[model samples]
Target chain A: TQLLEQSPQFLSIQEGENLTVYCNSSSVFSSLQWYRQEPGEGPVLLVTVVTGGEVKKLKRLTFQFGDARKDSSLHITAAQPGDTGLYLCAGAGGSEKLVFGKGMKLTVNP
Target chain B: EPEVTQTPSHQVTQMGQEVILRCVPISNHLYFYWYRQILGQKVEFLVSFYNNEISEKSEIFDDQFSVERPDGSNFTLKIRSTKLEDSAMYFCASSVRGGRGTGELFFGEGSRLTVL
Candidate 1:
């Protein structure tokens, strides 16, 4: 079975600090997506990276797909209290069904 | 922006009881899915529906679980008999092009099911 392993299961940082979360998998993926979920709500899509070595930016967040397509990363610049949430990385393989990572819980204290 | 919606934000039921969770995916979406997340656990895929049928389902979707798209917009998941392990937040999601292209899945707020 395909699996995505996320790093830094829990992170706590002061507002304005920078942080990075990583997702790795032993299998290749056609595309990878990043989502941020708040309490009592579903995960909100942040970005989807398709091509290997591709990078996309959304305001303070930057997402990168590894050259091998087996890993991905999310970097937050100057995190704010609003950025605190559970971050999840999911990978799409041969089928449309997604394989999700364990997720990273981020806490940005103001 | 269009979004997926689920009814009964929370449902409490006893073990061995039947429960049906309803969802209305985005009107134009062609693919629908059901997922569950146990408390403090990662989200897991339960089933995927397309073209009025289930295209895929996870191992977790056993004999007791069933999915149906009775109409154009509504998709439902029914559990014949609930168990304490079934307690979790069930999410409904939809995508226009199955993520093969640029379209991403839109998920509902989710229905929290507490099986006693």
Candidate 2:
């Protein structure tokens, strides 16, 4: 089974802090997606990186897909309270199913 | 802002009782999926449906689980007998034709199922 492992399961930081969450896997994936979820809600799509070494930015958030297609990362710059949420990474291979990470719970205090 | 919609935001059922979770995928999307997330756990893929049939399913989708697209817009997941372990947040997702490698899935708000 393909597994996505995320580091720093929980993070708490003050406003304006910059942080990065990592998603790593042993198996290669065709594409990777990043999502942010709030309490009692489903995950909201943030970005999708298909090419290896590709980078995409959404406002203050930057997403990177590893060259090997086995890992990804999400970086937030000058985080605000609104950026606080659970960050998840999902990967899809030849199979139709997508494998999700355990998620990184982020808390930004203003 | 087209998005997937799920019905009965919260459902409470007893063990051995059957429950049906409903979802309305975005119009024009071709692929539909069901995923579940246990408390403090990662989201687990249950099944994937395409062209009115199941294209793929995970081990979590056993005999107790079934999926159906009864109408053009409505997709449902039925659990023959819910167990306490079935309590989780169930999310419905859909994607357009060129979806797989592109990684664009629109998800519903999710249905919280509680089994007692």
Candidate 3:
């Protein structure tokens, strides 16, 4: 079974603080995707990293795929209240179906 | 910009009742999928549909669950009998291509299902 485990399942920080969340797995994947889901909303794709050791950024968010393709991480710089949401990492293997992580709920307090 | 849309934002039904969730994926997209997220849990893949047939499905999608693209625009997921475990936020998504290329899937806001 392919399972993606996320660390720091919940985080609360004041605005402007930086934080990092991680997703790790025992299975290597062909591609990894990061998504941010606001309360009551579906997940929105933040970035997709395909190549091992690949890195991608979107505004204040940076996503990194491990060299082994078995892990990934997301770093947020100077988080704001607007950045509060559930961050999800999903890994795609040989098929289109994605294996999603449990997600980290981040609360950026003002 | 186009987006996927779903109906019945929230539904509450008694256990053993049948329910059908609907979705209209982005036009021109070839692949469709259904996923669910239990409260405070990770999003789980339920099934994937393409070419008017189910391309893939998870163990969670058992005999009681079925998917159909009855028309060019609409996709539906039907649960023959609902259980408490089936209650979750069901999300519909689509991708222009399979996961290998971009691996980007566009998701709808989701329909909340509650079993009483």
List model 2 lDDT by residue over B49-83, tens digit each: 99999998988999999999998989999999999
Off by over 4 Å in 1: B99-103
lDDT of 1 at A50: 92
- What is the per-residue lDDT of model 3 for residues A17-66, given as tens digits with 9 covering 90 to 100? 99999999999999999999999999998899999999988889899999
- Report fnat in order of the candidates: 0.55, 0.70, 0.83
Clashing pairs in 1: none
List runs of model 2 lying over 4 Å from the truth: none
How accurate locally is residue B17 in candidate 1, as Cα lDDT from 0 to 100? 100
Give the winner by DockQ: 1 or 2: 2
Candidate 1 lDDT, B1-116, residue by residue in tens: 88899988999999999999999999988999999999988899998888888888899999999998887778999999999999999999999888455537789999999999
Runs off by more than 4 Å, candidate 3: none
Per-residue lDDT, model 1, residue B18, is 99
Interface Cα RMSD per model, in Å?
1.6, 1.5, 1.0
Clashing residue pairs in candidate 2 (N, C-alpha, C atoms within 3 angstroms): none
